[model samples]
Target: MARFRLLPDEQLARSPLRELWREFARQHSAMAGLALFLLFVVLAVLSPLLAPHDPYLQNDALLLIAPSWSEAGLVQYPFGTDDLGRDLLSRMLIGARYSFGIALITVLGALLTGLVLGSLAGMSKGLKSSALNHVLDLALTIPSLLLAIIIVAILGPGLINTIWAIMLALLPQFVHSVRNAIAEQLNLDYVIAYRLDGASNWQVLTRVILPNIWERLTVTASMALSTAILDIAALGFLGLGAQAPTAEWGAIIADSLDLIYVAPVGVALPGLLIFTCVLSVNLVGDGLRNAMKKRRDN
Candidate 1:
C-alpha cells in the first residue's frame, strides 16, 4: 500500500530554500535592485523610533552646523543642523512619513481609477475601447513631469495636490495594462461559457475576466507604487511638493541646498534618505515580481 505524505513548506524546506537561493543567484540583477529598495523602506517605517531628536524643534544657536564624527563635537546633531537650526536627522526621519504617505496614496488612487476605466474599455469593444485607449495614449504622450508641474501650479502646491498630480501621471499606465490584461482574458473559453450561461458583460467581467487579470493588475500596481515614490520625491525637491514648515524629505533637501557649501552634510543627509526610500520600494516590487514568476513557472 502506498502511504500519503505531505510536502514540506517550500518557503522553509531545504530543497526549496536551495531553489530560492538559486533564483536569487540567477536574478542577481533584480535581487540587488530589490535589496536596495527594502533597506530604504525599513528606514522610513522605523524613522520615529530611530530619530535622534525632535525634528520640529529649532535652536537658532545650532543653525548651519556641519556633521561631525563625534556626537559631542557636533553639538549632539548627528547629521548636523539645517539653516533654521532644525536637526537634520530628525527632519529626515519625519520627512520619510510624508514622502512614503504621498506615494502610497497616489499609487492606490491611480490603481483604482485605472482598473475601473480599463475594465469598462475591455468589456466594451470597437468604438468605446478605441476612444478610451486614444485618450489614455494622448495623456501618456505628455511628459509626466511637465504635466505634474502644470497641474500642481494650477491646484496650488501642497501634499494633497502633489498626490493628485502623481496619480494623474500614473493612472494612464494602469489603464493601459488593465485594458490589455482584460482584453486578453475576455476571449478565454471560461468567459465565453459564462456569457452562454446568460451572464451580463458586467457579471462576466466581475466574475471571470477580472479574477483572471488580478495578478497582472497587482504586479503593475506594485511597480507603480515604487515609481510614485520617486516622482513625489522629485516634485518635493523642486519646491512643488510639501511646502515650508513641513518636514518632507524633498523640502528638507531643497532647503539644505543653499547651505551646501556651508554644510554639505545637510544636503547629503536628506537626499540619502529619499534615495533609500525609493530604492527599498523598488526592491520589494522586484522581489514580489520574481517570486510570483517563479511560482507561475513551477
Candidate 2:
C-alpha cells in the first residue's frame, strides 16, 4: 500500500474577522468602546459630505441658535452653532479628522522610536545597556504634558507643532515599554537555547524573541494609541495644541467655554467626542490584551 500525504485546505484557516467579533462579544465593554470609536471614525471620514455647512464658513444670522427638535428640525444644525457662527456639528466632525490624524501619527512615531531604542538597549549589555536603559528611565521620568506645553509654547501653536509636541511627549513612554518587553524576552530560556545553538544575537533577538512577543507588542501599540488620542485632546483643551480655525476638538471646546451657557452642546459635542474616542480605544486595548493573555495561557 502507498502512503499518501495530505495538505490542509486554505478554507480551514482561521477567520480573523470572526475571531475579532468573538473577542469583541466576549468583552462587551470593549466592544461598546470599539463601536463608539468606529462611529466617530465614520463621522470624521464622512464629515465633508454629512456636515450641514462648511466648518469654516459662518452664518452670523444662525450663530448660537438653540437646537430645536420640534420640526425634524432647526435647519440641520443638531448640536447648534459656535460663537463664531460656525456649525458646531460641522466643526466637531472636521475636528475629528485632525484630532484622530494627529493622535495616529504621534503614536506611530513614538512606537517606531521606542522599538528601535528598546531593541538596541536589549541587544547590548554592560555599559551600553546600562546607559541606554538609564536614558529611557530618565526620559520616562520627565512629565510629558508639561514638556509638551513648553515645547508647543516654543514652537508656536499650530497643527504641525502640536503633532511634534505630542510625538516628543509620547516617545519616552514607548521607549520604556518596548525596552522592558525586549529585555524580558532576551532573558527567556528559549533565547538562551537559541544562543547556545550558535544563533547570532541578532538572530536570537529577531527570529526567536520578537516572533514570540509580537502579540504583546501589538496590544501595547494599540493601548499607546488610545492614550495618545486623549493626550492630544487634553493639549488642545489647554490651548497648547492645534491652532484656531482648524476644527480641532480641544480648541473647539476651549473656544466654547464662554458660550457654554448659551450653546451647551457646542462644548458638549467635542467633549463627548473626545471622551468616546479615548474610551473606545481603551476598551479595544483591554479586549486585545485579554485575548492575547488568554491565548498565551492556553
Candidate 3:
C-alpha cells in the first residue's frame, strides 16, 4: 500500500511545446495580443460576406460624409465615405484582406528562401560559409524599407513585384539568424555525441541541430511578420504595391491624403489599424522570447 514506482523516462521528459505554451499563456499582454490578431484575421477572412457595400463603388452624392455620430455624419455611412464616395468601412474590411494576405505571403516566401540559404551556410565551413556570411552582411547594411523601395523601383510598380521586393528585403535577417543558430549548435555536446554514434552529417544537421534551432527560428518569424506588414504598407503608400480600386490600407490612405482636412477619419483609420496590427505581432514575439528565456532558465 505504501510502495511507489518511478515514472518512465519517456513520461518524465517534458513537452517543450506544452511548456512554451504554458509560459506564453502566463503573459496577459501576449494573450490580449493574440486575441486582437485573431479578430483581425477573422475580419479579413469574412470581409466579402460582412462588408455592407462594394469597396470600389462610387456615388458623388455620398462623397466625404463624416463618420456616423459626428455632427455632420450620416448613419448610412458609419465610417463615412471617401472623396470618391466609396464606403470607408467596406474598403477597410477588404483592405485587411489585402494587407494581411500580402504580409503572410511575403513572410512565408522570405522564411523559405532564408531557411534554404541559411542551412547551406550553416552546414558549410571555411570559405563557403564566409562568403555567404559576407553577402548577408552586405544586405543588412541597407535599410530594409529602402532596399524594398529600390527593388520595387527596379522591377516596376505592381502587386507581385512589391511582394517579391518585401520578401527579398526580409530574407537576410532570417538567413543570419538560422546560420548563427546552426553554427552554435554544431559545437554542442549532443552534436558531438551524435557524430560519435555514427550519425551522418546530414542527420546531425537535420535531425539534431534543426530541432534545437526551431524555437529561435519561430521567434524570428514572428518578429519578421510585423516588419513584412510595415514594408508592404510602405510600398503600397508609395504607389508601388497595390494599385487603385484594390482596397489596400496604404493605398486607401494615399488616395485620401488630399481629403485630410475634409475627411480626417479616412486617413486616420487605416493608419490606426496598421499600428494596432504591428503592435499585436510585436507583443506576441516578445512573449515567445520571454517564454523561451524562462524555459531555458528552468
Winning model by TM-score: 3
Model 3 agreement with the true structure over 82-194: per-residue lDDT tens digits: 98899999999998888887788888888988988999999898998898899999999998899999999999998899899989999999999989998899899989999
Question: Which parts of model 1 are misplaced by more than 4 Å?
Answer: 1-3, 9-50, 68-72
Candidate maximizing lDDT: 3
Name every residue pair that clashes in candidate 3.
none
Give Cα-based local distance difference scores for all models. Answer: 0.77, 0.76, 0.89
Ten-residue segment with the worst summed lDDT in candidate 1? 8-17
RMSD in angstroms, candidate 2? Answer: 3.3
**How many clashing residue pairs are found in candidate 1?**
4
User: Which stretches in model 3 have alpha-carbon errors above 4 Å?
Assistant: 1-13
Cα deviation at 258, candidate 2, in Å, is: 0.7
Residue range 133-190, candidate 1, lDDT tens digits = 8998899898777888888999998888998898988888999999889887877888
**Mind giving the per-residue lDDT tens digits that candidate 2 earns over 239-271?**
777767779888888888887887678788788
Q: Is candidate 2 or candidate 3 better by lDDT?
A: 3
Q: How many clashing residue pairs appear in each of the predictions shown?
A: 4, 0, 0
TM-score of each model, in listed order: 0.84, 0.88, 0.94
Candidate 3 deviates by what RMSD?
Answer: 2.5
Whole-model lDDT, model 2: 0.76
